[model samples]
Target: PHYYSLLAAYLECQKVGAPPEVSARLAAMTQELEARQRTALGGLGAATEPELDQFMEAYHEMLVKFREELTRPLQEAMEFMRRVSRSSARSPSRADRCAISFPLA
Candidate 1:
């Protein structure tokens, strides 16, 4: 939800020609999210033994599912980009091997 909100705000900022304001808003949102995360983590120390165990179990399950869902697509995309980069280069340079190439705007 916050990501969507931030994206919408960015689009709106572009429409309004307020790029600097978008940066400010993004920075503010990042700080707010960090603070929220810190607060939630601080509260975790107060959880009962059973609650902590349950929370850890759920978190581990979520991490496993997230990695399973994301890993393959991410690897495939990275490989595709690498292939594209190599194809575009006459000879893949040392720098190209260490860096993911992106088309310049």
Candidate 2:
């Protein structure tokens, strides 16, 4: 959907790269890829089919592996946020204090 929106914007801008037919084909492929990404965790509708169940299992395994890889960065971000909050609480005028605060519009 987002890809299609991008393609629509491109057509409106008349960038003149791909012809309409070729662009439509590419957009369809992009839509398929986007659908795959959306269902990477596999929808809950039904895994009645054998192949669908296997694919879902594989996708779940991949998600676990991805989460394992993100552990360090996730932990570091939490720690960093905690440190920033602590330092900001200690001094309101500190240069990094604004990192935790947003100005009201």
Candidate 3:
């Protein structure tokens, strides 16, 4: 949701086509988002836990799924743009190497 919101706001700003004032507002919004993320992640030392190792092992699969589904497409598009004035495309789509591992002692 956050990614999509950011993309929409970005594309909207782009479609407005960079009048100087609009560009300044977009830059401000970008900074605002950075500040929000930083504030959200500011607490760590006093956090509580219930077997973090086990929770993390469970969520590792979730992280991989989210990264593949959400982040991978954006990464691919960025790579393609970096090639030949956006004339090139992604090399190939590879199957994800999904794995299963038993959590243990």
Query: For every model shown, what is its TM-score relative to the native structure?
Result: 0.35, 0.30, 0.30
Model 2 — TM-score against the truth?
A: 0.30
Candidate 3 yields a Cα-based lDDT of: 0.55
Cα lDDT computed for each candidate against the true fold: 0.58, 0.58, 0.55
Cα RMSD of predicted structure 2: 16.2
The segments of candidate 2 whose C-alpha lies over 4 angstroms from its true place after superposition are 1-48, 91-105
lDDT of 3 by residue, 10-71 (tens): 44435243567876777777777777666656756335465764566555545545545655
In terms of TM-score, the best-performing candidate is 1
Model 1 backbone overlap count: 0
Report the C-alpha lDDT of model 2 over 58-104, residue by residue, as the tens digit: 65556555545656576788899999999877886756655676789
Error of 1 at 2 (Å): 20
- The pairs that clash in candidate 3 are none
* Prediction 3 TM-score vs. true: 0.30
Better of 1 and 3 by lDDT: 1
Clashing pairs in model 1, backbone N/Cα/C closer than 3 A: none
